[model samples]
Target: MSVQAQGREIRILALGDSLVAGYGLARGEGFVAQLEAALRARGIPARVLDGGVSGDTTAGGLARLDWALAETPDAAIVALGGNDGLRAIDPAATYANLDAILTRLAARNIPVLLAGMLAPPNLGAEYGAAFRDAYERLARAHDVVFYPFFLDGVAAEPALNQPDGIHPNARGVAVMVERILPAVERLIEKARS
Candidate 1:
């Protein structure tokens, strides 16, 4: 899709797992749609494509990198690894997958906004630390825009999530899109630059 329309539009790909997919919500309630609406409300024309897949791990995202990029995103929000953490996968492996994804995107001259994910507490402190560290290290190494945690204010709030507790509700998706908007504008700027 075209990145611009009326010289103000941007095409952003929301690439990740369930959170991006809006697991239990209706079509328009997903993160991608909500983010697009939010941007438009803010007078920033944008198209946030649905690149989310429920239950997808970072490895899965890495595998689909080329296809995701085929849409020619002006910028991308990388939100994978949540499923990896939930599955208690090796943090190093997750890191490698994310690193590869970022590397590939960079090679294609695409700007990226890396949204971070925390490992489930039940996985123990060591795993949690490694998981958290991976995002930071990758963001620094790749020099991409970073949002520390994608689920920030809505993670444990039952009122903000669906019955599943993991995936967000419609309202929760709005909150996420709100919180991430500024960073996304910065990402848009990066793409333009």
Candidate 2:
């Protein structure tokens, strides 16, 4: 699909933290760009709005939701909670923040695709379990599309991730886009409906 024909310029807000901000990579090499290219390749006319803020936690996302939604995206991809996990914040708080985001989006009649995050194992088994479960609970409760783990195929692999061992490299982001595209496509379809 040509750039102009992607769904009447359907707005897609990618709200998240450093990874979405493309921390160490050039602008075009980031997740949003790659995801946009992937969507266009699939003939989905869409534009990805960068709502990422470096160092943003779940609370930060909630704080900024009104401003982000002011852009009037047709759909939203909520990719937060990573920094919360890194800081080992309470899983319940994380869940509450995400639930609020999802609830607000639902109230707006905007489709959401929740991108889940996994707490680092160093945080301990109990913490890890609770953190992972929060995503599951929110997804089920909100009935939104859920990508179980954002960094599923790229997280720890030195070849796929950057030297920081946190964010994924361009190739890794491509892998992530491929894995999550189906769910995101469904979100777009829902939004269009």
How many residue pairs in model 1 have overlapping backbones?
0
Worst 10-residue stretch by lDDT in candidate 1? 1-10
The residue-by-residue lDDT of candidate 2 on 77-105, one tens digit each, is 99999999999999999999999999999
| C-alpha lDDT score of every prediction, in listed order | 0.91, 0.91
Tens-digit per-residue lDDT, 1-193, candidate 1: 2223336578899999989988889989999999998888877788898899888999999999899888989889999999999999999999999999999989988899999999999999999999999999999999999999999999999999998888889999989988998899889888877
lDDT of 2 at 130: 97
Candidate 2: residue pairs that collide: 6-45, 7-45
Q: Which residue runs does candidate 1 get wrong by more than 4 Å? A: 1-6
If scored against the real structure, what TM-score would every candidate get?
0.95, 0.95
Give the root-mean-square deviation of each candidate in angstroms: 2.7, 2.5
